[model samples]
Target: MISIAAFYIVVSVLAYVTYAIDKQAAIKQRRRVSEKSLHLLGLLGGWPGGLFAQQRLRHKTQKTTFQAIFWLTVAVNVACLLSLTLYPYGG
Candidate 1:
């Protein structure tokens, strides 16, 4: 459980940094991070950080398609987390 919490903390921090970098790139008209990579990070239990980044950096917040997929990844991540918590022994 401690390891899981630590994993989430690390991944979420990385996700937040990634979003910040992407936002800066967008502002500078530089190459952007792939949407797939962002979504992958969210699906890997970084959605909390992703949500923070979306609100703080104002990145990828208005695109309907991206928003839809982002929410889906959040849902999947939450469901997996719930399952792990409820069935810690893989019942």
Candidate 2:
């Protein structure tokens, strides 16, 4: 359980940094992080960080399509987490 929480912390921090970099790139008119990449991160249990970035940085909030997909990924990730918590192996 502790390991799972640590994993999420590390991944979430990485996702947050990635989002911040992408936001900076956007400001500088540089190459942007692909939407697919962001969604992948979210699906991998980084949705909390991605959401934080979205709200704190005000990034990627306007696109309805992206928001829809992002929320879907969040839902999937949460479902998986719940499954892991509820039915832990070797219980």
Candidate 3:
């Protein structure tokens, strides 16, 4: 539905924005966004932008754990989107 698409778009944009801020903080404050926060966002359907940030900002890609977790996040988000598309609620 349009709502779902909008949700995805909003979340992706938020993820990119969050990652950009995190990158800036890392440069200025010597700290990155908390792993929990990043994971939560990705899990909530921000994986694409998280991935973009990972590649663009080069943040959180060095750790093997993060790599695995990031992929998992992407997978989960995709699955959720698929479900939303295939099974409309009360339709």
User: By the TM-score metric, which is better: model 1 or model 2?
Assistant: 1
For every candidate structure, what is the RMSD over all alpha carbons to the true structure, in angstroms? 1.3, 1.9, 2.4
Which 10 consecutive residues of model 3 have the lowest summed lDDT?
A: 1-10
Cα lDDT over the full model 1: 0.95
lDDT of 2 by residue, 1-91 (tens): 5687888887788889999999999999999999999999999988889999999999999999999999999999999999889988935
In angstroms, how far off is 64's CA in candidate 2? 0.7
TM-score of each: 0.94, 0.91, 0.82
Residue-by-residue lDDT tens digits, candidate 1, 1-91:
5588899989999999999999999999999999999999999988889999999989999999999999999999999999999999999
- Where is model 1 more than 4 Å wrong at Cα? none
**Segments of candidate 3 deviating more than 4 angstroms:** 89-91
Clashes of each: 0, 0, 0
Candidate whose lDDT is highest? 1
The CA lDDT of each predicted structure is: 0.95, 0.91, 0.84
Query: Cα miss at 24, model 1 (Å)?
Result: 0.7
Worst 10 residues of 2 by lDDT: 1-10
